[model samples]
Target chain A: MLSEEDRRKGAELLLQAERERKPIPQLSKTFPDIEIEDAYRIQDYWAQARIAAGARVAGHKIGLTSRAMQLASKMTEPDYGRILDDAFYNDGARIPASRFIKPRLEVELAFIMGEDLAGPGVRIYDVLRATEFVVPALEVIDYRTEVPRAITDTIADNAAFGSIVVGGRPVRPFDVDLRWVGATLSQNGIIEETGVSAGIMGHPAAGIAWLVNKLHVVGTGLEKGQIVLAGSFTRPVDITAGDIIQVDYGPLGAIGVSFI
Target chain B: MALDWKTLEAFAEHLENAELERRAITKITDDCPDLSWEEAYAIQDCIRARKVARGVRITGLKMGLTSLAKMTQMGVEDPIHGFITDYGMVPDGGEIAMDALIHPKVEAEVGFVLKRPLSGPGVDIDMVLAATDRIVPAVEVIDSRYRDFRFDLKSVIADNTSAARYVVGSSTTPFAASDLHRLNVVLEKNGSVVAEGVGATVLGHPAASVAMLANMLGRKGEGWEVPAEALILTGGITEAVPVARGDWIDVRYKDFGSVSLHFV
Candidate 1:
């Protein structure tokens, strides 16, 4: 049970880590009593400080949405964090290497909300109805906290969200067969990962449905006009400043970006 | 003459009804030129309460006419503040139904969210910078409810400062990541650059508007310290651009991402 001050300090350390482009010791290591709830509050504090400084929540990102990721993280469900406006990018944008300590790229789909979505009994269909469109996205996963991370630590680190680059074709939720959408992630012209949308809890929207239901417990819900990253389908690929990344979403479209 | 509680409630209802009906009405100040800012704010508060009563959530806050050029243009010494509601947000990359709005215009803005509560008698830029969490690029789609968008400042305040649809960038950068005053924004309409301005145009720095808002809100109460996590739109960086049906508007802020909207 981390105290309020402890949580605030945790956020401050992360902010310092962000500013210095360095990693800090895991919060779980420094504050062993920190619970999942505490981790979220710490993340909240980190985000709110940014908001106070003037960042806006453009959307949310859910992590560990797959069984493999959950198993790897030793968690049963996914974790999430707000996707601040600065963390968003256009396809083909060149990202500087100095922006992160260590960054990995993951292939995912992004859901753009068309209507408000809330919980208690939210489901995939509800998500489908609420989603205006889905586009191919690449999540630049980085950590401000040091790894070998605990679930609490990952949660507090905003699910290791570094930045998100979205491109390719966008389609309405019902316009395509989402379950079978496919992609191949290439780094420097070499195929490093391939994935199917079904790999995300059998449906990409399912995790978003789960997310809204979770947010409901906290007296919040997914607002309209927000973007949601539905979680990675392919395994994360290591990235460096000079690396070029391409994710081909088949008929949906493709995204190309480079780190410099 | 002082407004009675019943009259203020009626005023809120009347303006809100105009909004709901997608109709424009005359500004109240045209009739009652002596409307106090307090009463104007009270009426604005009443409108928000009415919205809450209808299950609409207050999303954030907005400041209007913060730029010296705009203040001088409007003949005002201080900027105005208003509330934003959830229903007023436009989806990123989404199109607006043109008929749903009345003479909408676009204002490219710098939006802020704070890490800590800010209240003030003496809040300054450094204080604002210290408290801010991150900076997000936003475009406010304002549709004034007054006929022909003409109204005195007090009357406009009562109309919630033309609070309407808004779109924010899906990314944010820490305050230290960029120089605020030097930041530049270009407003593009259908691929044409229509306007441009620097961040300093917003009262020398957007943070100054935030500081003024905090100080203004503080003076009203013990301090309605703009709370942490409150998303505040600092104000227009460029002149608000007019839009019509089938028009697309996009604003790009230096070092920040772009937010675009289309009218359909």
Candidate 2:
């Protein structure tokens, strides 16, 4: 366990690292007694502070859901973090490169809720019943932790969510079989990647089920009209200034964007 | 969906120079505030415009909150999504530039090629199985943008899920009546086994993760599209260990061939 003072100092150290772009010695160096859970508490404390500072919580991001990612991070389970309103994007939009520290882009699915969802036992059907619409989206994830973060560091960094883009048409939750949805991702007129929706837990909605059920224990719930990013089907990619990104969802229409 | 560039610039500058204490960031968020969700989205659109203006390709999509434990740890109650660009995708057995990234992590995953189109509402796991044309092994490289890698959710989303590089390994036998959960996965750093795991770590099985993704998209009125080959990375099977330049990483699935990556 970490003392409250250690938690505060840890938060302070994180802020300093962000502001100065300087590295802080590992938490192990400072407290020598810090546990992964303690690190998370400090991170949560800092997150609450950001929220209190008016960072309107938008949704959450899950990481290490894949067995492979878990091994890399040296963790057995998955991790998550929050998203704010400022992180969202729409289709056929332009993103400025100057605004981000080291921005990158990812294609994903975004879920828009139609009704409130709380859990402990929120089944996949419940998620479907409450969902109003769904859109093909892109998630831009960024982090605010020391470089070379461990799983604990990533969890503390809120799963590194940065921005999101939703494009093409909105499909009804009951319109099609989402698990097998297909996509061919092209960049600058070339095929760079391809994927199916089922790659994400057989169906992306199961992530939401996991989210609600997990959050229920924390005394939280997903509200209506909130957009949730299920996770990535393809591996993530890097972006530089002046890059055009387009995703074709076939029947769902298409989404395009560029970075300047 | 445009940012007050000037304000954003000022905030960035403030973030750079401010003390980075809880008090300092709190003061800045209070004083500078963040853009509305709509406004932030506009910024994303603007980025797309910029990309078009330049000539980068738009690649596949990524899921943000796929892990149950992560959601519980972050104090956030829901999951989010993001975008990927063609410029970001790296080929299998390829090298990634170290200078181009602030920090990068790798995740092994399962890739699915679609035989047909799929959409949502009642998309089921069986449907996914029926639609899967092929299954392959893959690796995702994640990096973030915020200085010192610090950001709230919104700022990070605007940055796009810290996407960096990825490599798809060789495909293997399909899950057709097989146990994806029990399959063994060994992660090797420079030809040595650094980590070992199984598919069950990713919410029990990668298929289950895909199932969740389908249902989530269905709620959004969007079903996973047809002919959409997906690399459903079922999150990390083990912890996200760090790597440096000149490091060679390979993920060997018991059923799937090895997927490899190198850093330079």
Judged by DockQ, which candidate is best?
2
lDDT of 2 at B50: 57
Who wins the TM-score comparison? 1
lDDT of 2 by residue, A144-177 (tens): 5545666656555566667888888889887877
Native-to-model Cα distance after best TM-score fit, residue A106 in candidate 1, in Å: 0.5
Stretches of candidate 2 exceeding 4 Å from the true structure = A15-36, B1-264
lDDT of 2: 0.65
Model 1 C-alpha lDDT per residue in residues B1-264, reported as the tens digit of each score:
399988899999999998888999999898678899999999999999999998998888999868564466577788999999888888778888878888889988888889998998899999998898877889999889999988989998999999888998875444452366656566778875555555665776789889999999998898487778878999887667789999989776655678889999
| DockQ score for model 2 | 0.02
Candidate 1 has a TM-score of: 0.50
Counting clashing residue pairs in each candidate, in order, gives 31, 164
Q: In order, what is each prediction's RMSD in angstroms? A: 24.5, 21.1
